[model samples]
Target: MTTYKAIKLIKRPEPGPVSPDIFEVTEKELPKAGSGEILIKQRQMSLDPAMFGWMSPDTESYIPPVELNTVMRSSGVGEVVESNHPDFEVGDRVMGMMGWQEYALSDGKGINKVQADVPDETVLSVFALPGLTATQGLLNVGKPKNGETLVVTGAAGSVGSIVGQIAKAEGLTVIGVVGSEEKANWIIDELGFDGAINYKTDDLRDQLTKLTPDGVDLYFENTGGPIQDLVVERMNAHGRVVVCGMIADYDKEVPSPGPSWVPVIKKRLTIQGFTMPDHFDQIPTLLQQLTPYVMSGKIKHRSHILEGLESAIEGLNMFFTGDNKGKLIVKL
Candidate 1:
């Protein structure tokens, strides 16, 4: 049997100087698909900010820690080579919550059918999990209305960029917040947002006051911490704040706190945090609305596709440092 390389977490360490040494790659024999199982040859893997939180041993979280000597947790697109499941077939392209391995054996639990004809890069770009996350988080939760102001942090990212575009499609005045002027220009000029604020340079409160003169109606909160605090205070009456992922504090040893939201009571603001699983049933609906726009070129997306599975760590680092624009995916 031939063995393949996999990035595995060898230890869980406290936040310390030595923590960087906790993860390593190792060769492991590829296992055969058992009955009802499908074997996947991973082509591209997603490196998200949330994966950093899952590496910690102390925090109680949505997913468990990657056990010592186990492959790191990641969502990836793969081609099925062997299948014992009736619903899946050999040569089927799929995406799922798999580990950071060249090959994976799935029992048909987390895997979803991916559009094989789409460019291999696009599967991990806008059509797969990142797209769904943005679509579900923005359209379903945001419910942005025509002429209303929709604001999003991480505006250049896969989720936020789509959120901004979708809101624009719905006739909302989209205001995007990103870390760089280059990203700001891309969001405004390329993605059709009404305005883009370079959060790294601008004073968010004053900028929001000038840009969203009527106050924000829908705030798609992606990066939390100080930015979140500012958005909360600037929300209009009956404004909705959809807390997606908090990328800002994800890699921190100590999390940053936002301003007290008790004032939201008097302002009649609606603030809610959600994960994709909360509205799993909405996935098909989101796909129906988004896929057409994507196909027709009405909706567009970008990705930073670095080559090789070894680049996954670098992708994660880019995500943490806000260096990546659009979705960050590593090709295997």
Candidate 2:
């Protein structure tokens, strides 16, 4: 009557490169919901590239670091199995920073109500951080304009994929940069992007020159590395760069040098870096703008969902390795 499975961060990742061995799933006694708190049985946990930063030692960031032996921090959707709060009901489903545990004890701060009938995939992809991130970073930061040439790195990912489609809807040309031919085709053919370049196999400069003949007006940067430098080089005057993520350097012990700022001055580029926590107040506006495209089937998404808490450790590696086809989530 008392125990449930949950994953905990057993140790911090080392200084140079990191591995998934830091996590361990174990049985823990369930905690009773006190007055004004609720008990939630988690259904799904969203996997993201941001975990890299979270696994490291504490730093000034949108969220706090995961202490050793604590439930690894994560966002999840769950149902209220028991409640001691006035606002929440026993059957109500909600989403929030529920971490990697099978059940969460919450006082209802960041949690939000979720429709029971809505597919978990949709909730995890478009409505969660992925979709909100794309909306906030691209619309608020990138500021896409009609007839502009838009380039997105990690274009096959949750945030980048949505950004490309949204830009297309707004009357801009969308070009995706992915790591494979299959992903390249998926973004262009399935996701309606105008063009796609395979960064791993294709000649980077050649493809950028051919595909972006007009130069990039807005760059939705997701992965940082040589690809980022190449994309920066192809940017046009007055271009905007929306810094969403940098999966390329996630595993590196020592971070590499970023793209030079000389181009920022010469091209007069606007470069902005953002994390979702700072923009939480804008979720409603983002959802209002993103809902129509999602309902109409314009904003398509994919996911590589792993089952159970055990896979949680392995599933995170997918983001860094490009092994996951789409959004990554751990289905409980």
Candidate 3:
């Protein structure tokens, strides 16, 4: 029997950096594909901020918490090594929620084939959750208009970068709020953002005033912190706020208080929070909306790759540290 390593959630994490002790790594005998199922040899796994919520004990989140003693939940790109299903064949490339393991067996419910010719990195980086989230949040939820000004927090991250680029493509003035000077430069110089605010060093209000002289028309909230209030204060009347991830407060015992609702009432702002799982059924439509931007060269992406499956354990901390340059993936 062939064996493969898998990580299981043995204990619920406390409010802080993820502790390695909560997970138990073990080796198990690999199983063959059963009737109407496919076996995948996962090549790359994505590390997302959402995993923190999934690991928590909260039962009211958009998705259920990963049950203790089960494989850690994650999405990955893989190739079918064996198939008992008619729709998938051996050697077919695919992507889906395969969890933190070397091999995955699925009944072909959510799994989708990777038909694009691009490398697996691109598939996981741009076309997977990042791009899908960007499209649904910015385009469907935000409803941006041409000549409007847009500010996206966590602007250099996987989803935020795509949101800024898509806003720019739609003729909006895009300003990004990033953590470091390097990220600010990359968003402005390379991603063609109108301007960037380094939340760490820059004066948040001063830079926001200078960059968005005409009040923000759309705000893409990715990281919740001090800057969130400043951005909300500068929004135009009837502006849209798309709340995505709140990484800054993810590990805290208590999340920071949200911005006052006075402005929200006075400005008549529209605010909505969304997760990709709710929009999974519309994936084909979202991909249809996002593919043109990629095919036409408007979308550009970078990936920070870690080696081996176990590397995923430490990679989760990088989200809080802002160390990973681009889409964080573990190459197995």
TM-score for all predictions? 0.93, 0.96, 0.99
Model 1 poorest 10 in a row by lDDT: 12-21
Best by lDDT: 3
* Per-model RMSD to reference: 2.0, 1.6, 0.7
Tens digits of per-residue lDDT, candidate 3, 172-258, equal 999999999999989989999999999889999999999999999999999999999998999999999999999999999999999
User: Could you give the candidate ranking by TM-score, starting with the highest?
Assistant: 3, 2, 1
Candidate 3 collision pairs: none
Residues 102-168, candidate 1: write the lDDT tens digits. Answer: 9999998868888636876687777777788888777777778888988898889888888888888
User: On TM-score, who's better, 2 or 3?
Assistant: 3
Query: Global lDDT for candidate 1?
Result: 0.80
Clashes of 1: 0
* Per-residue error (Å), model 3, residue 237: 0.8
Worst 10 residues of 2 by lDDT: 13-22
**Residue 261 accuracy (lDDT) in model 3:** 97
